[model samples]
Target chain A: MSENKRTEVDQLGEFGLIERITKDVEINHKSTVKGIGDDAAVIDCGDDYMVVSTDMLLEGIHFDLSFMPLQHLGYKAIAVNVSDIAAMNALPEQVTVSIAITNRFSVEAIDMIYQGIKAACKNYNVDLVGGDTTSSRSGLVISVSVTGRVAKDKIVYRSGAKKGDILCLSGDIGGAYMGLQVLLREKKVYESNPEMQPKLDDYEYIVGRQLRPEARTDVIHDLREIGIVPTSMIDVSDGVASEIMHICKASGVGAAIYEQKLPVDQRTFDACHEFKIPSVTPGLNGGEDYELLFTIDQEDFKKVEKNPNIYFIGYIDEAESGARMVTVGDQIVPISAQGFKHF
Target chain B: MSENKRTEVDQLGEFGLIERITKDVEINHKSTVKGIGDDAAVIDCGDDYMVVSTDMLLEGIHFDLSFMPLQHLGYKAIAVNVSDIAAMNALPEQVTVSIAITNRFSVEAIDMIYQGIKAACKNYNVDLVGGDTTSSRSGLVISVSVTGRVAKDKIVYRSGAKKGDILCLSGDIGGAYMGLQVLLREKKVYESNPEMQPKLDDYEYIVGRQLRPEARTDVIHDLREIGIVPTSMIDVSDGVASEIMHICKASGVGAAIYEQKLPVDQRTFDACHEFKIPSVTPGLNGGEDYELLFTIDQEDFKKVEKNPNIYFIGYIDEAESGARMVTVGDQIVPISAQGFKHF
Candidate 1:
């Protein structure tokens, strides 16, 4: 960098910066079927397509250890990576976890973390293959990389959606975000009164959602069992509104979601009401829901119509129509969300 | 953890902790062929085996920004990961890099780092497939994961060595460690005298080894062309003695290295003299020299005998003898080195 020429990263935003940096990257191998723009990179591995996904969780950035338990943090790290693999319609077979932590942490503390990691590995049926562990000078950082395989014909990408496809969601949203708010509120209460025991019984469900989220790999299995492949799919890491926009943009189509059809659990709704937050806003714009956001052909609706877990929220439209939402009061509005901005 | 029980991480050491943590990990998938130990994890990918390796570099733990350039750091991260794949006798095809940095980094700063990453990707013929970028509360952190493939019959593990295997090394060692000493000394001189410039002209070769060490992947290609597979192999990351011991323990054999045959470049030798360090100490105990250390059967020695880059350094010994070194004075002594300890 020149002495006088420096541009702040925020000017380009995260997506824009990634686009500019990766735009010129050249692919050198034929095995690399997909690169740079999806839940995972797809590699052609003979009879099947191998998918690789990576995620990094930093202390004070992705989680606060004061409230987040070490075991839960480890489980969440694996779950998030497995979520990406599930998004590709693949079965995660192996994972590599690399962690850097300060000496302030004890071996027992690290064991607690690995106990959580081992539990997640067992739950997801993924082998803990390899990883590098080293000491850190600051907060703990955990980075996990997962590899999975899918039949070549069964692979899914975010660019496969078409007009008239039905948009679907696996489960409820906004619980993770609302759960974080409840934890923060309780933490503040305890910080002020040393003798006060935390009253967490009422917020158990939401808090559990925030602390430990299971990747929706079971949904991928269900889709395969029902013989229904999603036209396009992406795991909701950033919020529903942003994910809808991503699918629409990638597929060169548009989406119109119905607010009344949005799934919000009763606990999440009650918490949002008590917190004075708009009930629908968290589902549309909140983060870390880790649910499946996918599209399927309208003809395949019968296969999922009887399924209680999957919710039909909307439909894909023409490219020029843009991402939008139909309110409960019967009005169409364009959807724009300030997706989670870490920068 | 119990309220009254806690074990400090230092007591168990890195390897002991890893062993205890992964001891009960049961493999759930048949695709996972190897896990937890070795330079890279091996996965059965039908006709061939896919290898996965991961590494994490923390700012204050692995590097110092004051002396290490961001571009070189990026290049080194890729090189080290590639080295792990080469140790498994696989051809690296794809890599994913995840980084966390504070807002203090400029767009240009990140661009510089990517420039080096792209350059290394091009140099090594590996594709940069995908990665995650996030904000950090403290300093910069980079974690890289690489995937490679090798034929099932061609892959070599650290436990494949025989009693008569000849030990060999690719290229020189100790240059990187000496170069680091030179840089640190110059940094101190500059810190004490603002107007003084770093005298790096006389130490360019060693300094380059420090800043931009290349993975000896060409040797892997050379071995393939010569139709010879190593009995066992590992990269010299924690110095040669430590890596030799790893192979010995894993292979259930011992090694006898010749002190006179140790390779040290002229600049590294001069720097070691200036630094008041024994010439052989850095080669034995200093770190970060990414050279290949392997064992070849005696019958295959004729193939690499004419290869200038492959230096015959030692021979495999009986397990009862342990790892030993033969000095120039004709005395043999057991070799024990204090490897790089991050904690």
Candidate 2:
């Protein structure tokens, strides 16, 4: 309703936008150790802290059916919510999904969505305990809620990072974002000329990252095996720079990340260069990576440093220092979040 | 996309269409003792069967800001989901809400919604455990999931009725339906001329029924106090006739509801007459009454036989008899669902 209204969501992107909206939220529940900065919300249950997280995927906002299959959407829905639980350093046990679809979809379409749901359930060792199915006047709406458990002492929160904790990232970053670029480019090409087939075979890795990103529950198990518990943890749904800043802000600390240490997959690098987008931009702000970012005490670094899966990106620092990113040339640059702006 | 073009939902009215679409869902979860028939879905969770229920309200679909206050919308959202839990003869414990709104909604709007949610939580003695706040492209969307607890033995499903069980309604019906009528009328009057007052003062009872209908959780308490566990239970959401058919189909029994014993408030009766609508028709099929309807065993009859709040409207019978209605003048006629259709 603004008179001079030309503020498009593209201006802030996705990660930048989420930060702006969630900036003012304050957690009031003692049980809620962490809220909104992680893959899942952490709560203090009696026996163990429970991790609760929810995600809503609007049809056009979060996905495109022309390229993203229905089954994968269902799978991704559960996976994203599960990723939230994993970010809390917990194992997901149960989930509830609510979907609203138009009549344009047939029973077969629903079955396919369920097939993806069942597959995800099997893959993650979770129970599809409950959900609601209703008709949507427009496009499909999928909302999922996941619950997981972790020992009270073992639960990780975004606000627990200390000045000297080592920052660790599980798996690579920006592959999903790069994959989305590839998919969008191919779609544009196909739209321009129907006879042109998408050259997707060359971009399989990045494409798969966009289509079926996995939640890193295995990392939680591996962390336990290596006797390393993160002091603070969050999932990389909104890229590393944004997530790191989230931990810094919530924990009342600062973070400094070395750009050269960021784990970027070869395919993502190739795709980013092909698309003419700055590789660092995608690595820092492209959302939906679904990787784990955590901070561990300096002593715990020895346990996970040798693990190929864990990348040592940076370290937590005093709050007054502020969050920053060190470029490849050793110059520290202030980080800016271009979080996904769904509005 | 069907070639045989059907009328749009807006033409059918929200309630009318919802009733039509939800008519044929088959409940398959044995844990789900009851599904859409009740205010909430009932689950057989070990020592205590849990109640699970969800409600999704799209901004344009379910409410309008021109008239509906955000606080009330939040309260109604929780109340509706909680009512589903109460319908299963359970006490609600926790809830998860997922909200999607455009940037047009301020942080203050979000806070107001949370304020209402917190108020409902305190009033219902439930926990504001978890939720998701995300961006919406078009309108606001709120989806709530509630979890409630009831003893395994006390938990009731819609499919538990048997021959000779008494059919009872917890409170008067049709008030909400009439209240909606009054609000709609006022909304139209105001739309036609912006200066017109809503004139809701004289129609407080009906308007309250429409805007702030209460879930009959107290009825569950009363049943416990009198030691009268109903043979079957369901929340009156889609009206009496539709819910009765659902119970009958699920329990594989038939019922005969007496017309004379149907409870209708004086105001509701007067409103129905004023609108030239049959009073019994609205009482029979008007949805959103938020009353508890259940079947009780003959042995427990003595416990609630004299309770003024309870209305003994009918009795369950053999499946072969089919569901029917006994007219005030003694004619027995087959009962048909004339409930709200939401699709």
Candidate 3:
């Protein structure tokens, strides 16, 4: 119990800690085609590969129950896990949810959470196959594990991108970040004056974006329909810039994204202005968007060129070039990912 | 939020709550062969069936860190999930462990937990595939999801026992329950007087059972080697009486177990005597044993009859007979399952 060295967890960071824990892990199963360091692990299941991913959400760390409805929290739990599956170009088939709750929650509260879970299951066409529910000593803890399948040749990875591949983003970013700002502001106002009705009518879009973000399964479907699998794929759960760096590092390539091309919703921009936060900052650093960030070969761009939801932001480059962002004013700056400091 | 109804979760109980939440769930995937009702969810994996199970353990609710070592806690987490897989007569191939911790834990403490996890993974021959590590507001929470495979025909379910099947017990039971009692007593002593050393030397057997229960994979191996698949099977996680009821309900049959036939280690019996708790009570209701309970066709009993580690406890009966226990004094008593009430 008495060790001279005591290093804080924050010192290692999330990814670094993961690397340290998994460093010595050796895959003993032949069916395990891939393990760790990916959106989902791949297991060879004869005709196709089974993809597995798990996520744990703690109350105060992952969400604030004050503004986040139990139903939306439940839906987001499933959606976020499914986003991992979608990131691997897999179709989610089953999910297992495990929750630990304290007595402060009523049976009705649990039902509301399940309602949201069921809604997400229906929306994603995934089955709620199994789960565990237990009592917690404190706040709620929700952990979800999703299983998905992809054709052997169709699976995508963050390490698959090549130089000159066009970077594509599905839908706008920063909405969820702006939504969180609005929710926090409203919460503060409500705390200051309990009788005052919080103004939320105009911030509905951004707030909804934060509370009920959906997995970009539509983009996965669109790619499948067009028969063009992305060279590299990742879900933007940790913001665009961080995910871009992940793809670049894993693919041993470089990325150049245009700030002017970064998609931002009108409502999100307005909220960002009101909050006195730079709109682009949220787009680059705001998380929980659940959008798909991917790279496709330049030749295949024509197939999705007219798609309104897909935005071409930039292109891949040689590894020596490193990751950079071209500002709206035409100045290029090195892009550094400031991921969420949950620890 | 107020509908004039407030039913506490304790009223529904853990199993009842699970049934209530899963009552209206509809499975949408063809790959999902069995959902929500077995030791693990069964999925179609082409030539074989894949069984998946997940469990979550919170700090205070599941284990007290004051007496439970971090390493043993990590090992127990994986072992318990693997026990669910073993209950389905499957060999676990991979597991995903998601953990949430507060800043109170040092990096070294986290490593100790992972060290135990890695040890269990090595012992069980399962790979650590994927997991999520995040921050918690308070205590540590570990959620493990395991995937195992079994030949389609060899997969065992709790619903397969027929009348006259001989009930079999693997290794021993009630030891873990006694172990917990000893640990709690020692913890109380240590708390009151920090200078006092825990008198756990004589309680080693029971204490070890509580701290480091192993999944009965050896029993599964023996059964496979002997070419004898049980008619029905489940892990003795929630004590023998509760598991007996599960089998009877699922298989539409009743059971009759002999109290004298129940296996209790000498140390466990001694601890039970000292604590003044009936030895039979722990055998019937003491949980966390992690032993395999199964029913084999009467004809197959001869194969395991001479196996020293296996014990013949009882036999399956007609549904109309009802579940009962033949006491040591020859008096018959109806059995009731008082499972762990974590809720």
Alpha-carbon TM-score of each model against the true structure = 0.98, 0.85, 0.99
Ranking by lDDT: 3, 1, 2
Candidate 2 — which residues are off by over 4 angstroms?
Answer: A1-49, A190-197, A225-227, B1-50, B64-67, B103-115, B151-154, B186-202, B225-228
Using DockQ, give the best candidate's number. 3
- Sorted into a CAPRI-style docking class, model 3 comes out as high
lDDT of model 3 at position A173: 96
Candidate 3 to truth, TM? 0.99
**Which prediction has more favorable DockQ, 2 or 3?**
3
Predictions in order: lDDT = 0.91, 0.79, 0.93
| Top model number, lDDT | 3
Q: How accurate is candidate 3 locally (lDDT)?
A: 0.93
Question: What TM-score results for chain B in every one of the models?
Answer: 0.97, 0.88, 0.98
Place model 1 in a CAPRI quality band.
high
Candidate ranking under DockQ, highest first, comes to 3, 1, 2
Candidate 3 Cα outliers beyond 4 Å, as residue runs: B1-4
Please report, as a residue range, the 10-residue window in candidate 2 chain B with the lowest summed lDDT: B20-29
Residues A1-343 of candidate 1: C-alpha lDDT, one tens digit per residue: 4756988888988888889789999998998999999999999888999999999999988998879999999999999999999999998999999998888898888988998998999999999998988899999999999999999999999999999999999999999889988888888898999688778899998899889998999999999999999999999999999999899888999889999999999999999999999988889988888999999998899999999999999999898999999999999999996685431
User: Which portion of correct inter-chain contacts appears in model 2?
Assistant: 0.10
Instruction: Count clashes in each candidate, considering only residues at least 3 apart in sequence or on different chains.
Output: 0, 24, 0
